[model samples]
Target: MSFVDRLRELRLDAGVFRRATDRGANESAPSAFIRPRPIESRSSKEQSVGRRQSSNEFSGRRFFSSAAGSPVSRPAVSSPKKVYPTANNSSWTTEAKEPAGERQVIKVGTGVRPDDPPSSLCPKPRSPKLKVGITLMTRKPHRFDWWLRYHRNLGICHVFVHVEDTPELLPLLDSDEFAGFVTVTTGDDNSLDTHNPNSPDNYYTLMQRQEEQVRRSVVSARRMGIQWLFHIDDDELLHLTEPFSRLVRELGSDVTCITFVNIEATPKSLNAECVFEEIDTFSQHLMLAYRNGKSAGRVSVADWHGPHRFTGRYCVVPVERACILHFESCTYEQWRNKFIKHKEMGEAKKNDIPFPFYRDSVTLFQEDPSGGKNEQRWKAFYQERKIEHFEQLHEDEKIRIRLTSCPKQMIDGASGSFCKWRNA
Candidate 1:
């Protein structure tokens, strides 16, 4: 507490400070505690370095140059950025398919992308010059537009339509919608009796009418340079494992006629709706329909003799992969409406040579023209067509094929033809 004692303590403190100042910031110390720094002339003083190694040396490793003692920064090596590929991305999908908009490229640190699957999986469409046409005689068809669009998507360049009685379809087929695609004919050609096309006496039956239409259509097909002409009813569709063009191109040059086995459709109910969408499960063997199958003859050399038979320099080849999707009595309304209209084909008179379905249907129409009294019998016919169970498939209904898509789907859209559920 005395003034003399305080003065002695102050002098001792001043001496300790002077000794620490002598060492200065330039001195290397074990502890990172505060040190004294002195101002110097600009000539000798390192501008940034000043008289210190680093003001905050503890933040990181501070390496200083031997000459000027300035700090040098050598950043730590960084690991690569993690790239977790998302589902449904270019990580694994077709190269032909790109993102909706302009694509972006992100080059990761020294990372390499693996080669993708070849584009050959989605082959390009065939040349349109190699034309294939369909010769059909449809009368008031259900989903006739769908049939046209389906075959068009299947690479049928042209369609020769014989309007048995559907005059409305004539203009519709000749419209811009089907201008160059369809060749329409009404009344009768020079090939048949023009006077009485509807008469029971002349080409009135289903077989005769169909053959006559096909025969005349073949000449048109040949003249128009249509290589192959197929005769398929509006009730039936051409089903293929691959593209039809590919199959036709694969056929031997010498082969004139191509026959495909028929797969009959088994309706689930009398509720007639969209046939292709509603009907997915088809029976390999024909139960209530013909099993002989349908044929497509090359128009250049072959003549359309019958529905299935072709004449002139014939070399027939069977492709097991393709078949006809026959919607024979697919629905109650379809069955009733189709056959009921052609009562003449039934008991009204001999349809000349009606198919088994027509024969059976027209017989009912013949028995009961109105189908009023035989309603239960008609119901029985529809019920019999239903497949009760896969466990107990009939001998004719052995192999059951569940199509991946609807039979009336584009080749590219088959995988995405879950339209039933989407529309629902």
Candidate 2:
């Protein structure tokens, strides 16, 4: 028999028709009393055929049961979908029925992720300003206050001082005038023994100590974020014709050094008590031995041969406007003592042909160790030389004259026009 005929026969035998007929005739029939129709038994071949047909009709379809007690089918999704958390603390996902070719970008959140690129929309941080500092190696504490005041007036922001004699000079560092700006340090305890012939410090040992002190100051300046560093002595005063900061900013990156020629200032009389006060007059002749202008940046102190030049590998830029005013011949007592010290340190042995100034000073000291008659002779010699009045000249004229008066040896291939003044 056919599958449908068999199903009919099985329902009739189970009395399903009687129950359905009774429910239709009585409108008041309870739902609980009305029984469901029993499924009819079928052969394995017939069951397999029915399952195959059902699967075919329901392929790519989903079913939903309605309130009217009927099953409805809708098209099913084909692609997988993902949900992501958004900025408003809510979850969202792409439409399952969206076309495969099109993609919508979802801003995940306002917060940054580990793999996200840095945001260019935000403002960048500002950089710090560059600073400059000066280093001084001073043996005389009495002149410290004066030196500090002079440079501070020239817009010097920071200072590093290495006092040669700390015990006598340490009290000066505590002054209120130098509270925030100045740093005081002591000389090295392991300084060279002047008496030992085999020691490295014996030969130019004083210069060696000065170099070591300067080196330490340079390192300290660098650590403190000082972009430019200048080294000067206690007796030397640097006069900047222009603003020091402007000069530093104008220097090229490749130019690491700046040299200034020295102009020796002599007193009218060797009997003058204070040379600093008598600095109104300066010598017309340029002292080739003392070129001691301050250096640029952090150069090695050992590289500095004298106050005038740096021997290291650097591009040296000479400042025509700025010059170091040296009070090398201040007083009779100071000069005599300085000469004696140099003589004891074997200065005469080192120089085969010493400068006339040194030779004369040593001769006079030898002839009159008391410095009474020698002072008068040196005073007469200085007075005979015509000295230029610094205050009377114009700023440009002073720079021009000094530059013109510089010795050729101090500057490479430099031809000064004031040749007549050298002999005068």
Candidate 3:
């Protein structure tokens, strides 16, 4: 039996997978969970046309709310790790906290360049021009154009965009600013499900689609002669300071991947129409802002921090620099429209999954044959046990923006965000 099948059996054995009406039938039924939307592949030529069409496809918008509430609202937990000794009543031991100063030299390039960058003091040699690949998964044109400009201004030699097959994006794809600097990749909307794994409706096919997307996107960057592959979803944007070129020169060999600041923004009830504003800056970018509080223009989050397994929203292998911005949340209308589009896609495709996955406290996976009842029960139990904690999180919930100059000091093997750390 497949792992999923075994898992289903376990859920039943554990008394969590079935509804009270269910009798653990011998014959399985068609999965009620909708399949996830397919990821856009850079290899697809259709993406080059940048055509927006009306069909049953997922909308990249409105998956989450301004409150960021949704069944998908599971707070990404930190990766597992070894606990370091604490200072309480323990003998003080020491370990090197800072990265070792020495770097291993690595020569980059297929052939020697006429004007190659100088050999680094590190053992490795620098590549010709730093190649960067950028991914944006959105149907909207406004945010797409912004990212294009950022990469071009950053002197990045190449750019790749992943957007749904939509006509609204054609003009921008055809724009002079994007000329020669951009390549559009086609994405299928059918592979965008956000169902919980516990749901019997959750199909292995949906999970595979997501994995394929990550694999294909990374492979495309490798094919493009890009040493660094950066990721930014539709709503997210990256911010950076030093030209990536300078960063390549400085951290050439030691750096492999980079983590960037995640700046969470939301439409706030300002003086007039809802205006998008940053509420929190991840620690990395927080240092970049004027202590006096000035808005540093939007930047790609991939530029600074490396990818955390939990917050894969933005991250990349080392290209030339080490900083970027992430604008994951935007205005409410745009957000709502996104969910509406996804719902339409679901209905047309016959997936029939509810729009937004979570509505009026109902999760998209609630109908899945697996643990649908238990999942609901778990949520209710969580609310009951941690009512105060959940309320505090909701009440204090505000936009978060972070900026970090050095990521190595802030991240551990588990990839937890440590605002401060000392060797012990």
Candidate 4:
């Protein structure tokens, strides 16, 4: 990289934007619910940590260790305290409250260099970069590329991308941008109900694949020296108020699991083509599907409760408000494609499952699985829920839409990285 080339890549912009209305004044935060929960520092306590030692496995106060099938634990180091950050209570501006087309956050990184050496005034030695990684499942090139760059710029270190649906895209993972950091898997080792990428797989099979991947990725994360690992989807993004590495520095060694709250992102209009780029506004009033969100746990978790959780036992997960921005059904095409896949795969109707969309698809497709009639049914369902205007969200019959800016903060904060990649 020559001086001229490096200079060309440099940029200058506000780290974050504030609206003229400063909706934060009236709303306080995104919602009345955006208050940070008080977590007592474990540094004050002197309780003895119960180290659960297993054959070739480590647990309790350790980073990541699974039993039976896992590799030997790494040489123990005097690790820093474990503590997750308190959710942000920062003020926010909502789309409904602001003028049309007014954006809340538009941030960019200016390639700020590190401070020269720590002076006596700031005597504390800088801690190691908190190596945080994420487990994601991706297929579409456009979607995966954005996800990789966004999370990478936002502070995610290693990425475990399972290109389950499209093995053809596996070669792309070997590219320069993804080579060293990303670990690509194709569910090749594990014998599942299906192997053909084009073949239809039921919802159960997909869940099995996710759980299998979780099992394998934990061992890999541990080997790679990743202390904290989060499991999220391609359509979803983790919106942290602060850096994830810093979040780990705040948590006590006792806590093992973190439950990230999910807030659904509603498109600004009926057909908001691109969900990630176009859709920013979110409703926190608990609408559509379950609100279980996602989870991030230490690689040392013992058993698999589900993909969202690593341990069946008590792992000290906090009651978070909303940390994950879930972009589900933001576009008519998105909704149409999802149901079509579910229908074609012969997804069984699970009564216990609260995912109404999948269940509805099963019932509807029984009448007509394909053709123009099926398309009409999906269109009707989408129209009933789509937010045509700000007023529609304000007066939603199912649930009131209280616009939030949690995701936009992270998105804009890494704007420079996104722009550079787009140009490159």
Order of the predicted models by TM-score, top scorer first: 4, 1, 2, 3
| Top of the candidates by TM-score | 4
lDDT of 1 by residue, 44-84 (tens): 32232211121111122222333442223333222212111
lDDT of 3 by residue, 1-424 (tens): 9999999888887775454324333113111111223334324433312222211122221112223121111122232111111112121211212212221111111111223334443234334665665544455544555555545554445555545546678678878867677766545433334433223333233334334444455555566666665555554444432334433332223334444433223223212121212323222111211111101101222232212221222113221112233333233334333333332123223333221222211232233323246455434422432222222222112223332322322110111221222111
Q: Candidate 2, which segments miss by more than 4 Å at Cα?
A: 1-130, 165-167, 191-203, 271-274, 283-289, 292-294, 298-320, 345-354, 372-424
Residue 388 displacement in candidate 2 (angstroms): 13
Query: Cα miss at 279, model 1 (Å)?
Result: 0.5
RMSD of each: 33.4, 38.1, 21.5, 19.8
Weakest ten-residue segment in model 3 by summed lDDT: 289-298
* C-alpha-based local distance difference test score of model 3: 0.34
Clash number by candidate, in order: 0, 4, 65, 9
Q: Candidate 1: TM-score? A: 0.57
Candidate 2, 1-424: lDDT as tens digits: 9999999899887798776665464333211101212222222223322111110111232121223221233334565232222222233333333332322121112112223234354333532444656776665533556666666655566887766534666666767778678887655544323223224223345556556656666677667767666676667666544333433333323335555445556454545544554445443233312332345553333244443334432322222234566777465545555555444434444442234455555555455555456456645533442122223322212222222212222111111221112111
Q: Estimate TM-scores for all models.
A: 0.57, 0.51, 0.39, 0.59
Candidate 4 overall lDDT versus native: 0.50
Model 2 pairs whose backbones collide = 291-307, 291-308, 292-307, 292-308
- Of the two candidates 2 and 4, the one with more favorable TM-score, higher being better, is 4
> Which model is ahead, 1 or 4, in terms of lDDT?
1
